[model samples]
Target: MVDFQEFCKHLPFGLLIVNYKGEIIYKSQICENLLNNSDPNIKHIQDILPDSSIIKVIKEGKFDISPYKLKEEMYLIQIALEPGKLGGILFIPEGVIQDIINASPRVLELKHELESIMNLSGELVTISDSNGIILRVNNACEQIVGVKEHDLIGKSVYEMEKSGVITSSSTKYVLEKKQKVTMKQTTKSGRRLMVDGYPIFNNDGSLNKVINISKDVTEISILKKRLEETKNLLDYYQKELYVFQKSEQEIVYQSKAMEKLYDLACRIADVDATIFLHGETGVGKEVLARTIHNLSNRKDAPFIKVNCGAIPESIMESELFGYSKGTFTGGHKEGKKGLALAAHKGTLFLDEIGELPLNLQAKLLQLLQEKQFTPLGSTSPVQVDVRFITATNRNLEEMVREGSFREDLYYRLYVIPIAVPSLAERKEDIPFLINYFAEKYSHKYNHYKTFHPEVIQLFVDHKWKGNVRELQNTVERLILTVPSSQIEMHHLPDKLINTKTKVRGNMNLKQAMEQFEKQILIQTLETSATMREASKKLGVDASTITRKVKKYGINIAKLQFLL
Candidate 1:
């Protein structure tokens, strides 16, 4: 008396007939958007969502569904038990309507694209009606919210928050305005998301729906919050490393330009001269300044940083110089010690020096010339021993020529100019820097970190718009969420990875030598299982083999003799 086709007709979405185990025995209609180019298979629900949890519900004959945001593709799938048939419909979201447009099986771009999306990790996606009703939700959202996706749909936006107040008022505003909105939100799943709520407009210019794309930024937020703490920790570790590890001064530097920069920074570190650091953002000005300080006579003293760009012009002077009691509004009853005094025996780093107002510039020039500065409301000239390290991405030389900056102060600060080369200018340092940070943050974050050879080339090939900061961020990003034990070239960010997708295969003279070495080492190792044997076979000295092995981290002991 139970009709199988009649049972499927009761479901709202596309129905697929399945066996007793809920495998896709037969699909009544192919989910064109999801399986349009390929045949449907009986696999785990993660085939549609990278982090979906759908198998548990259908196997138990209970209702299960989850939203999946696979990169550029979005899907809302639902599955409920049927008595006669094993499976039910898989309701995909409306945007997947594009998957229905393929006329032939000549291409599989959509298939691969959806597959890629179904594999990416650490992402959240959702779709809602004009009323902000939950029409769809992804597994990431479920994991984040600690609830199943089916339970989420048909639940009004009102009953969900339960705080009785509509959270993310921006989402409401976006739906009303029918415009895209990007902002930060904390999900019910206890994670921070950089959410982008994009409103889908109907042809009539009315609000049809909104798609909320989100990225989990919990790790990034933690890293950003502990940025200053991480600095202290890194400084402590680096200093400790110097004590326990022997200093390889020559190894500390490999690039000639870097060596020249270090030489210039070291020469001016001991003296209390105003050293101007000129480099693109992320070229490691602060690190260089600290290194200079560490190598200087004032290694024992603190190196204070004044982020001029972050401070307002009105209070910039007050912050740079000390303030006496009752000198200005909100002044400490006990006079505050300015940075100049705070760094009495060490270095003071002024970042974004070009932004310092002209008035304050004059005062700074006076202090630099007079070798002392009186605190606000006090006449006594408080002189102290402090080294000045100023850095800027702007061309101070141009600013002076344009009359925006004081020439006298410019000349004073330019006394010991040290230009930090951008990562592109001296790309040989990219690999070294990547390895150092990978090792450093691997221990710091407790994450497994290793680099592939192609990954190194990708780093070297990047435009590095943010400079070393950009590269460091890219490295940190890889270490945090790259779901692999080893970092391959493909695991790098799309921007960096794409740059090398069509790289020229030509290697210059040095590259040829390296490849020759690689071939010799590979053949030697394959023929013999000992470095001694491989070296003896190749007619090279064993010490040379050892040096090359150390340089490349190759296991010489496993190598064999070659012809």
Candidate 2:
């Protein structure tokens, strides 16, 4: 008979014996070879087969057979408790089932077909055992991760990470989670990768392998960054375009004072703070307020303008706070939403706010403080979401002192007080405004007209106490009523023509004389039909008058136009 050790080594299956303490007592030569262990003694069977069911078999004294996976191979294992002792024995077939399958011609063909499919993929594909050993990698792996198949295959992912071949591994996460995982990784080639890892399990519910599919997203990431930058640049240019268009259409100005004021308006446009516009009448305060509303986030909402001074005091409360149905005789049967409610989620411009009655000022103050107000005949307070932009020509501070305007209401409206300058203060913008309004009214009345130089000079010199409103009305009147295309000094209103040009600074005798002479020549040219008539009226030779006319740069054509 053969010796026991030799006979056990010659057996076709691998065997392991464990004592009741679950410590390995004996292992055959085939078992040692199958487990890839060369040691004479092993501490536990779990050291080789970590998922072994031998301990349960010993505890319950039961017998069971199951498939055990090791690395990339599968083996059928037989587990049974010892007949008379509190010990267990595990029988593992020496020939792996995967090896038997690999030997078949059909399985080999399918394996080659699968490998061809995997290598043909554009995305990097990798397979690693549960122990972190890389078993296979596709051809795309070299192009994406800059690693060769031979270099990564059979190598440990942890070692590759330590060696800096790849920055991180999704396989590590899959192993930890025992589920699918997706992560971003970088390689030594400086390529960004989006990797999705899937954990594959065996029939015994034990981790078998991790499959990682990776896509090179380096170009996509760069393109995304560039797209974001382009979008931001487009937004900036669009805003600049809006400001330019707005300046040309509305709030036309060129003076540094107006420029600075408009810049402040734009800066505070989007904020929800209450804006108080204070200026003289006809100073374009309403236009400026509308500009603010257009630039604000509520540009799409309603812009309700209520002239506090225009409405009568008796119905002012109902017009502002709205009234319920049948609140008063002859009232609308369905009731009105009122100016405040109509301007919901928008701007409410209360022009001449200082003219608001004392009692209504209290209600306005309540609305400003609490964002809610009661209708005239309603017991319940209706909420409102309105941005307040109030304008006044009167001094609210003086009114507050006189007990005419509410002190609390005045302070509430004074949160962001912006003083709009009168047109006379920004005289540099006068010529441009005149031209804009001239062209505007010319279009409105369907007549084209131009102002004579002398008429424009008179407009610039005259102190427009009525501000822009007076100037706009004058331009509209001239455009409508002036018979000729060229508007001269005689075409102006008597008030504008008779107005004396105020000498702004201290002038010497020569400068005063020259200015007086220029004015006389202009006036004489307006009345006189001919150059000879103007010279005779001045009691000067025609040549002297012509020399003074040239010196003063006076347009002799005005006399011709008048004729």
Candidate 3:
């Protein structure tokens, strides 16, 4: 792709055409590069360089020369606007003054065009000697500085410093660096001036003449300060948008219900509050809770997961609240920190918090309220800063009403409640889930079999009452039994693909097919107790049902006895 912006990058030495009224309507080849070292075509010169000398030359019809240096090279670039002609001149320093005379025809032509013109005027034109003495200045210099340039021509440029510009080591530094410096210099006239100190050097790189170009900046400086404040505000908003983008992409979803949940999760991840996850077994509740933790402010801190369902009710208390070395039988000899302590300075995800016995719920509630907990048999209380996120399939609200769960604990965990929808509601996502499970099991058992479209649809259409766990088990079974390169619809359990529609509202398309499939498989198996006879009854190859039975997670032991 051709980028015109690339061309704008080469415009340090530039020219322009302007009307008598001082508005610049056109700039030459190097104008864009001079402004930003980037795209040159962006309109509006004031926006590009708010304090522009382009306007000054056009208004006053001035012949202006500003000395500048870049990368060890000196330049005496001159700008001139002639009367009656709208065109301008850009006399660029060609390496050294002598180099311009011997350069290409294009350079020679431009030099001739600029030198032929005369009678240029501007606000101020200053010429200084090699020793930093003011050598000459035009009549406008008197009006601007409130002093006749002729009276100060022989004096050192440093002597006119009574108007708010106090020279520092910065002046010496610019000379030593041999670079252009922009600074404020007060003239003897008590006028505040915004100035640029330009250094001019000869072909031998010796100091020649240094010129100072200045403009009154009392108003412009105030606007610049305001602009800085707005930029700071934009930077903060940009950071917030970045966080939102990262969180949105991290939420992986294959189902609509989950998709909505993910969007909601991203919105509130940064908020300061406890969150609770509720879902059935094997639905990745803990994983979701951890995701919230990783997205929150405390991401760099620890993320501790304690599965209350997995621990014995008796020791659950001791495990959560640290125990003294000899507090109980079988306690750690050196005393162990509890799960709460281990989770300090980060998130503590209490999985299956509902299973925490009612007697212990009070203690958990107390810790949440005070943000502190005492280790079992340790009289001293331990204070810690921790964010608690709990997950449970059991309905804490229902248990509270039944008096089996603590009401106080229930409210504490339900601050930001999120319900992970059941798999049945996301049946539209069954196809994706099937593929994921199939791939996982195939890799686990070192067996590979691709599924036919019809076979996969059978899995998708089936009512997954057992949700993801049951679905995973079914995939593992199919991987073990199916021998063909592809699994077919008949390979699915007859109860799913062959079932009668008579199965009440409990039956989706999958359950109906499954019932019909099972009847055909059993009848065929009993007819000859042979795959050949079974495949014939089901109108498929004997190898197909062998795969179907495994994939459907059917108990073949019962079928064999009946056969």
Candidate 4:
């Protein structure tokens, strides 16, 4: 039989023999090479391997195994008692430790349990190396990533991304960032996925592996898109409904000019700026101001209207700013809340703003700028929150030049000036207005009536100097005074009918003749059923009548109702 030392030398491991006192008695040449020392006699085992388990093995006299590191290499240190129980023998085997552990029953059972748990998870899980090479994937990979485990395993993430298997790779980002990463990705099968990647690091703080988990968000994404579309459609229909309601309840017009003006008003209704309305005496500026107030955030609050021209100069200040008790003999016992205070947190419409007294403009300016005012016979300033909407038919700039208006107040009110179009400017809306007023007053006076085509034609041809007010007043008069159900030409005021034949003194004979010819054509078209009939009645060709109608800019559609 070979001796112990010679036998240990031929073994595929380093060997050492320590006595009961923990001193090394024998060591193989392999052990000397591993420890980097040739002499070992009389040296304690602790001196060679400071963290060794030789002393415990000697005391127990049992076989044991542990992991040990010498320099950068790892070894499995197996310790056992020597013969006669005098010492302990240590076997340091190079490599093959992992193979031994994997072959063990307990380790194999634990590995199978971990793999089962990973496979049963609902989220898609994948393990890849630092180089983006896929190592393992769970069963959820097929449902989420649209790829089977066998197809994805052992493949490079970079290669799969280039082939359109996935839109992007979270593992690649994890390797680059050396930390956790999350991102949205799309698969070749049109699945949207939210993926999270966790990186595993080595003992030296280097990236070792990346574990990725993904969730399917395809249905959620589609639902989110559909919800956005539905919300947009609802907003569009809501705006249309609002416009329809406004047209019925307030201002009525079918002209493009009015449409554009109302669109601008609605757009700026929410803003808290001082608006100045400029128009003729009866172009409906007050109505527009009220519409703005109704559309604003303060619709629930009070809307106070003050006609600056209607208030007497002697009592204007007291009426607008209120007066303390006993300020005058005729005053009420208690102090009063003025119109400005009554309009708190709401709108204050100042019609005929140009008619405001020159001295009072300064106080009005103070209220507008500071939102506070001094009541009559009171020393304290009363606070208010009022939105000012001023309207005037007179030229404010001319008044400013004439020293009748304050320049500062003009600028403050001129912040947002809207020029309301006159009825003559938007003549296309006249017919609709006439019909609306006719129906309105006929119901009011309990008389069901209509207007003859000739009467409507004369009304359209007449210039309405007072704008909508004049037209509305004329319609109301016709509905009330006319006894017949159909209002005829004789019922109209002479001024309106005379407009058809009245010639300005400034016109030459040829101009007057052309005007006369235009009137004749209009009258004939109103009586005839067609252009051919009108031409026959006038002794001219139908083409010549058509050319003359075009030259005169006649609206034949308006006359179609008569035919």
Candidate 5:
């Protein structure tokens, strides 16, 4: 006389039981809600679950479980066995299984976002279940793995590796070690691949899935071979002829934006037309100008650079065109040749050209047109053969429209315009730039160091207002200040570690004010030791600060320790 209905009443999942005669005996409260029926004895269990395997289990006197669909709803049917007899059948709804297996909404959203990112990524991406069954593959996999995504989706990585579909599998290693693994993989077509596998886990610490990212290093291998072949020959000649000249620091980058800029610069390097470079301050404008000069035919000749704003207005003309022996007091008595003359047969780079005075613009225009300029206190013009390269952080066209810059000069220098991208625009280059700066500074300071991966990730996500220069300076500072070999997050400057979120595009006044307030609160908390101190620093009461902190879910303990 067992009360089967009361037996599974408190379980989170629904449960139903039927006697071996196929008549419904008991149903849990959850099942009543799920099946939308309260009466279990009104009909035979066969009518409710017509295709259930419970009937077969009962007839064969064996326990069984199978999926049963009723009116577009799925349920699990489990048949129980009593001592020497068939017992009853139990039913559990599909929704209960989903709650046990599927992730939360936010987690699912993040997973979807990760998948989207992988889909758009340049590297080959493959994701597989814990058992090495491929679940998804990015478009890049089709080319690198030499198989269509659809063909690989449901296949096992072990079987694929055994069949030589892929030369190797990082997923297998990750599963074996239960951790991230990185190794070199070779393709059937003999392409060298750099593969990294990351293992994901469920909340209960069980294996979830494995994500594999691979890059084809075929071109890199070829370049390494070529370098090996040429290094000795170049070194011998450089030493024998005493022709070794220090090469300027090359632009460190691996981004598509930089690639486009490099290609554009190369295309126009041989041409002698005036080139104008435009970008934000510290975006490597001068480096690009130097790159152009070095790539040109006049690389061996003197390359003179002038900052128009740095020269006094009274001596600007004298500095550019040279002053005669007595043209001005305190001038070089030898009547030194100005940058224009000094750069003859080479290149002259004019930085901050937008800051040039109005009177000097006319002279600059004449020099461009006549290819000659009259020195101060001289009657005759001095002929010159110099290519002109101008750079400006300011908007020259806007200045021309506003009448501060000459329209003719603007047009003359705008022959070939190149725009250098900001650090934020080319975030992919952050890691390379960080590594370069870290190596340079580490060598200079006689200290070997490396950055924590999380620190590097923060640098990549930061909005570098000062562009490449700011990133380089930050890296140098970290190398010098960090006491340990590994630069951790705590070693970074407070400003960098607690940087406010950059507001992009446009926003309404209320939204702007909210962001500003949030930034202020964060800054105050970061610098202050306690809630009262933060409140006083921010010109607010302690209660107000506490209220706002709770609203924003700010981590007060971490903020207090940041200082």
Candidate 6:
């Protein structure tokens, strides 16, 4: 009635149990600890100790106590048989069995060492039986799964998946395939785990156990995604930069003032000082900023432009200096990076710098002086390496005197000043500009057109109050309308025609009256939608409007669209 296997496990001497077929079924703790056997279960008794008579004694149902030598150590083997003919092999050393019991403390230490090995491992280790019942887990497993080791030890992996403790298990694959398997797993606590399941085989090549080594991969996955996104964004920026560079190669210039300005720009391009470009609104300040950036060593880096007056005052700070996560209502859950941070190791062009609000001017000054700025609602400042190029039509010095703009900020941004000439100052370049615009717009509108010599002279003589922008618009308008292959003097806007090209001309009264009549007819046609409208505006009938348009050779199709 007694359970002999349990009784033998408590004994000091080693004991092993084998079936009648010579297969090891059990091995006691003391036997494994003292013998230091990597595998406690040996299939045959002869394999444990060669030339053993223990199996013969079990077959004949006789008690045999004999001397046995194993690994050069003397031991006594006692063989017995159970009612069912199962074999029991007991090993006793040359000394008394009580001496082995006295060394029981050593066995306890060995057990503790095994536990320490598992507990100290950084990776999560989980052991399960061949039937997929969880038997044990290391300390790291508790932290990863958010469950106690004791709670998980007796449970089945299937039950855990059903109960939502873990999303899935890699042990199932090891059990089914009887080989090593690796898979991604997610726990109920939202930890991403990479689990490697290795199947431990018995001597008979059957599945004995499965050990899963898991590593938390949540942070690694997030970092990889961010890296991919950054790579893609960088590719996009590179393409845009290619386009910008190609267009910059097309800038045309012929005037002395423009030639001098370009030479100065090229000389200062490599310097790291702050550059301030001053010009009228229509003059090409932004173009000069691009020239400076392209000429510098940082040309390969980003060229970010922000219009201070265009961005609203409310979010300008956040737009300039990034904000932390959840810093404001409707903000991105993940923190946002600003243009300043995006422009690190590159150039940041702050156009219309004079229009920046007074309060934000101090922060701009901080970035200029300290090379850092704290984002809105953030305590820490982010440092940036940036070459600043600012452009504005406003007179910052006059504003500084009037207390409208900060004096300290003015000096900070005004380190190196370059003045761009207005369209009026470079009047000699008018003919060249006219031809350039004519070619540009003609190609854009899918046609060919040329300006008459008189028309070009008129443009050169006219006061371009709106500067280059006005001239560009005028040229595009003439190309788009003006139905003929040639844009003539009559195609000129009334404002340009009315302004005399020559101060003193050789025209007499007859020629002057005819020129005045032509100007009146062209101006009225431009302001009206139809001949009838022009006739009403000019205080004439439709027939007279029609006759004047033909007589003056005005492009009526151009007049209709202009209205």
Clashes per candidate (backbone, < 3 Å): 13, 0, 23, 0, 0, 0
Q: Mind giving the per-residue lDDT tens digits that candidate 4 earns over 1-563?
A: 88877777787667777777777777887778777987636388877887776677667766666667775355645355663244554544545566778889999999898789887768788999989999988888888777889999999999999999999999989988888999999999999989999999989998889999898889999999999999767745644565667435657876678888888877777688999999998999998898888777778899899999999998889889998877878678897879999999999999999999999999999999999999998999999999999999999999999999999999999999999999888765676688889988988899988986555655666799999999999999989999999997677777876784562545555665576568667766766778788889789998999899999998999877232
- Per-prediction CA RMSD (Å): 31.6, 10.9, 25.1, 9.3, 31.1, 19.9
- For 449-546, candidate 1 gives per-residue lDDT tens digits of 89876566556666788877887788888899888878986676666646765552555545645644664455446546566876887689988887
Model 3 lDDT per residue over 344-433, tens place: 889988898888888888889978899998888889999988898888888788898999998878887789989887777765555556
Residue pairs in clash, model 2: none
TM-score of each: 0.47, 0.59, 0.46, 0.57, 0.46, 0.46
* Overall lDDT per candidate, in order of appearance: 0.69, 0.82, 0.66, 0.82, 0.79, 0.80
Give candidate 4 misplaced runs (Cα > 4 Å): 1-138, 146-215, 241-247, 261-419, 493-563
Report RMSD for candidate 3.
25.1
- Against the true structure, whose TM-score is highest? 2
Best-matching candidate per lDDT: 4
In model 3, which regions exceed 4 Å deviation?
Answer: 1-252, 494-563
Worst 10 residues of 1 by lDDT: 243-252
Q: How accurate is candidate 6 locally (lDDT)?
A: 0.80
How far is 303's C-alpha from truth in model 2 (Å)? 2.4
lDDT of 3 at 541: 79
Candidate order, lDDT descending? 4, 2, 6, 5, 1, 3
User: Candidate 6: TM-score?
Assistant: 0.46
**Model 5, 1-563: lDDT tens per residue?**
76655668767666656666766666677766766777635667667666666656666767765666644455575656652334565555577666745667877887788878997868999899999999988888777877888989999999898988777789999999999999998877677899999999999999999999898988899999999879756644533232112123446765668878876876677699999999999999998888777766788998899999899998899889986768767777778678899999999999999999999999999888889999998888899998999999999988999999999889999999999999989776777688888888888899889987656666876789999999888888888888899997678877766752232234444554555456556655755667787777668898999898887788877664432
**Candidate 1 Cα errors over 4 Å, as ranges:** 1-252, 504-563
Candidate 6, 257-369: lDDT as tens digits = 87788777766776889999999997888878987787777998999999999999998988988899889889988878999999999999999998899999999999999
Count of clashes in candidate 6: 0
User: Which residue pairs overlap in candidate 5's backbone?
Assistant: none
